[model samples]
Target: MKLYYTPGACSLAVHIALCEAGLPFTLAKVDLATHTLAEAENGSTDFYAVSPRGYVPMLQLDDGSRHTEAASLLQYVADLAPAAALLPPAGTVARLEAVGWLTLVSTELHKVFSPWLWHKETAESTREACKAKVALRFAELDRHLATRDYLAGDRFGVADAYGFAIVNWATILRMPLNPYPALQAYLSRVAARPRVREALVAEGLARD
Candidate 1:
């Protein structure tokens, strides 16, 4: 499999998952500025051909099929290595809850922060609005995380990966994480994971 991604983008979640699952995959870095695979004077056209949407986190399977969406990609990678405990078993109540949190992270938290990160035109207004909304969601997760080391209880499931990937945006966007102590600790824990560290470095983020 080949995962096309931009460094430090949402695709880092899938990258971390693949590493944790012990999956062998090639990484194709995308230049988001040009929406292409290679960094060149003129961007490589190959990646855009594979994913016309021109987005990162496009997973090209062994069979040459492409899957988008970080939330769904999390499930796909988890199923690929069920023994790793990345996700609970399918069709069970526990698994259902895991999926619920994944969806929430994607739709509620991830999408809410998307607008502010990509533009400067209305970033201030959008960020102020999103700050209040994300704080509520962050507090909800903070309360839940305060009692557990990982999301979905003792295991580090897919939801935790998605959550960490989204919430880590606080640093890049200059959002305040100091107010949410539990959430702050949670990010630190996630960052300290070996696989996650590997992903962060691979995505050109700091090794620390």
Candidate 2:
């Protein structure tokens, strides 16, 4: 499979999970500013041809089929590598609970940061409002992380991959994590994982 992504975007979640799962795949980097691939893996510079939504984390499978959406893709990758236990097995209560964590990461954290806080044209008041909202979510994460090393279960798993990608945005975007030491520590913990570190270095988000 070929995973199309923009460096340091939420797609990094899937990239890190794929690495941890020991999956074989290539990467196609998208220029989100242009929504074009520098070298299109699916034979089109126009990313819309490969993904009509013009989004990153579009996974083109070996059969030439494709999948999109990070939440769904995270679960898909987990199922493919069940031995890795990236996610709890499907159709179980454990799986449902884990999926709930992912949904919160997506709506509360990821959506809160994007389009508003990340865009310069957004009004200062709007950015402040978004940041305020994100802070509430951050506080919740800080409290939860205070008692656990990982978000989903006993080990670093799919939810950690997704949460790390979104929550690390606080660092990248210069939001203050100093007030949430537990969340900050959790970020550091996730970043130190070998596969997560490899993904980070590969995306140029960190030095090896």
CA lDDT, every prediction? Answer: 0.86, 0.90
* Per-residue error (Å), model 2, residue 137: 0.8
Model 1: colliding residue pairs: none
lDDT, model 2, position 1: 94
In terms of lDDT, model 1 sits at 0.86
Candidate 2 clash total?
Answer: 0
Per-residue CA lDDT of candidate 1, range 11-34, in tens? 988998999999999988888787
Q: How far does residue 23 in candidate 1 sit from its true spot (Å)?
A: 0.8
Find the 10 residues in a row with the least total lDDT in model 1: 39-48
After superposition of all CA atoms, the RMSD between model 2 and the true structure is 1.4
Give the winner by TM-score. 2
